[model samples]
Target chain A: MNNLVEIVNLTKKYGSNVAVNNLTVSLPKGKIIGLLGPNGSGKTTLIKMLNGLLTPTEGTIMIDGNYVGPATKSKVAYLPDRTYLTMNQTIREILDYFQDFYADFSRERAEEMLKSLGIDPSVKMRTLSKGTKEKVQLILVMSRDASLYILDEPIAGVDPAARDYILRTIINNYNPEATVLISTHLIEDVEQVLDEVIFMRYGQLVLYTSVDNIREEKGKSVDAYFREVFAC
Target chain B: MLGKLMKYEWKNTWKAGMLMLLGIFIVTVAGCIVLQMPGGVVSNLVDGNEANAAQTWLVISSFTATLILYVIMLLASTWGMLIFLGIRFYRSMYTDEGYLSHTLPVTANQLFLSKVLVSGVWYLFIMIGIGISIVALLVSLMMGLMDISELSGVLTQYNGNVWEFLGDGIYELNRVYEEQMGMNLLHYGITLLLTYVAGPFITMITLFGALTIGQLSSKHKGLIGILAYAGLTILSSIIGSTVQSVFMFSTNIVSSAGGTGITTNWAYDINVLTSALVAAIMYGVSYYIMNRKLNLD
Candidate 1:
């Protein structure tokens, strides 16, 4: 299988606290992989490392074929869990910013998505509600034609209605040739859309398998299997 | 990419500097207008024609009040540029804004350079504005103190030829230069001008470095960043002071047994050199932290 991301002995620590343990995983291209882990399971830490936000204490992460840097960042579109755009900027300015920075960014696609949601590009980010801001962020991320899409908790705090809208946007705009890594612990809501699921517990990888494999061998839905495996 | 980054940085940061520039211009203009007013109440009171002494007191008191206000704002805005730029760096690099900044397809050096250049430009503008304001205020004060007709008479005393007056000033300066051969006026002027022009950029580097160091902490980053700035500034001052002491001793500005003997203002040169050195060290620290030790919360 052609892997889009290759991690080797990845480990991240904060002083004496270990965030990502000494384990490695390879995520394949052209699939929606769910990085399922509860709070503090090193999901965000690993995602941050992949996006070059944090440095690893040991090991390395390679995107496509090269080590992570400006080249890899160009191909990797990241949507951080927080609102990263300046609140003082208008949506139009942000669109211009993305278009300038990312070659893979499509202004037409982003405009279309914004139009469908009835979001005015001239409006400032400060005027928008939190849910609307998240939607705008998701639209920007999904609009990119990148090699890897890393979404950290994209649907964690939104209502079920907004969550469905988010899932639809992801599904509708997902580039078939690209890899999507959605990191969230809310497994049931995202299980149906995931092609593969990787369960993480206490910074250690518990399992990595296809969603169909979990159904066939465990004789249960991925959500039910997740509950059984991660029951606390 | 650096140009684009600088363009956006300037776009975002222009408002603060613009507000300050406008404030200085407006206040200076108001003061000049007041000074130029016809038949002012203060003049009446001063000439022993206190027909409306109460009105004169009110007018003078109000002008004093507003003068105080302008002075406070002027001082704040002049010195506030460094602090404001430091805060800007903190917000863009350490807060939620950092997530987008670090993930962009540009290198860390490009980002740092963009911010420093944009900030340096604003500092230059604000410094020029303050300088213009001070010169205007001084001219206004001179006009208020001296009778305008007499001042014009004095101006035409040199046959209205500005160059002739400038030549006389240069002749006096030449006499002084002859008496003090060690003081090269032209060279000293160039050095002074260079220091004035480069001061803002060097100051910006130190602040950016402190802010980058502050990013290492997981909590209370603002407080840590401020502490870092204070620490760095103190260390820089110590270095500058130590170099200045050495220069004074070697040049005999301070003679043996601590007997005071001073000539040129060599301390200023030592301070400028030390500041440039500190800025270089700070830039290196910031670059390393941005690339390797970058741990954003």
Candidate 2:
């Protein structure tokens, strides 16, 4: 399988502390990958670098064959951990903005997703509950036909029902030709859908292997291995 | 893409801009009303001497209008531009709100360019609006709705040497009108818009410099960003002042000779050009920093 993302000697530092240290990894196309890490394991940083939000300090990250730039950024759909939408905007307005900016954005898909969740597109973002806002953000991100979808803690703050909805949206809306990189500590909920798992510990990649390979080799699931690898 | 970005920027800022424009309009109207009250049929209806009322009202109205427009234009333009640019920039960076901004497939250059263009266009619009309003008031007075005869008589008296007698009279009149309306309408407006147009470019540079310094700092990221901005500001100020002083000194030398010669107010032109050059430098520095070392993350 062709690699969709290639990170070579990618290192990122915040002051004296290193967030991602000399990490080298290649993710295959059209697969769901779980980036599992502890509280300070650099999962967010790694994901950010992939989306061109943060520049790597020591190396390069390429999306498909091209390097990170405007072209690569256009092809990547990012859902941040927190709500990114302005509080004053309505869901419909936000969707319009998205449609205007991103040619790949699907307004119909976004509207359908929001309706399914009982979200009123006309209501201001500030009026929505946190879980609802997250779902809305997720729906918007997933509605795009992007080459890569980088979701950071997509289900972190939501209720179980909303979490399931978010997961279902991701699974159903993502294009088959695209890859999904989900960064979260809620490993068990996402373990079943992941084709590969990358375990990070203290700004370093401890393991990068497929779920099938790990389960077959060690008779353990990714969540089980996460506990073992990140055990204090 | 630029068009879309500009459209959103305009839409987001339209409310504030309209409020400001309304304020300017009110001040202008008040000044015109005051000017017309003195010499027109209204004065005759009042219990005052028609001639004296006419004279007093014209002077007062003219002064008030000029002052009000100046003040309102200044405040409205500055506040409007600042709020618009500041909010957009703040949202575009340093917040999760930037996910949409950064993911738009537009470069940092395009983003900056869009902001600059919008600011420039808005500022231009404001200038035109103020100019047209002032001219309209003057036209109304000339058409006999206001007792502007005294003012016109004064100008006509110096018609042979209008430019010299005026000695910035037109500008002064406009200023007074703006002031009376409780606004610095034009000065502040122009300054604000110019600042808005130039601010982002400066900020982009500051951000780049700050991020670089932050990376090098032993302190926290936030602290480093602050320190970097401060450092860059201080550095730029020093350089700017030094350049200004050098130019002023050189100009003084040239004008010292012209002081004894018959060369008019050439120094004023030089001063304006020098200020414009400094602003251009700031703009260039901003673009350079953003293009060269922008760390989006």
Q: How many collisions per candidate?
A: 0, 32
Q: Candidate 1 clashing pairs?
A: none
Candidate 1 regions with alpha-carbon error over 4 angstroms: B36-63, B148-158, B170-182, B253-266
Model 1 lDDT tens row, A1-232: 5999999999999989999999699999999999987789999999999988899999999999988888999999898899999999999999999999999999999999999989999999999999999999999999899999999999988999999999999988989999999998778899889999999988889999999999999999988998899889
Alpha carbon lDDT of each predicted model:
0.86, 0.72
Lowest summed lDDT across 10 adjacent residues in model 2 chain B is found at B260-269
Across B1-297, the per-residue lDDT of candidate 1 in tens digits comes to 999999899988999889888888888888766654455554565566655767776667756866886788688887787778888888998889999999899998999999998998888888888788878877875665557788568679898888888888877885685355334465557668877788888878888888888878888878887898889889989988898777756656434455443334566577888888988998999999989988888
Off by over 4 Å in 2: B39-73, B128-281, B288-297
Instruction: List, in the given order, the native-contact fraction of each candidate.
Output: 0.92, 0.71
**lDDT score at residue B203, model 2, on the 0-100 scale:** 48
lDDT of 2 by residue, A38-68 (tens): 9989998888777766767789988978888
- DockQ scores for all predicted structures: 0.86, 0.59
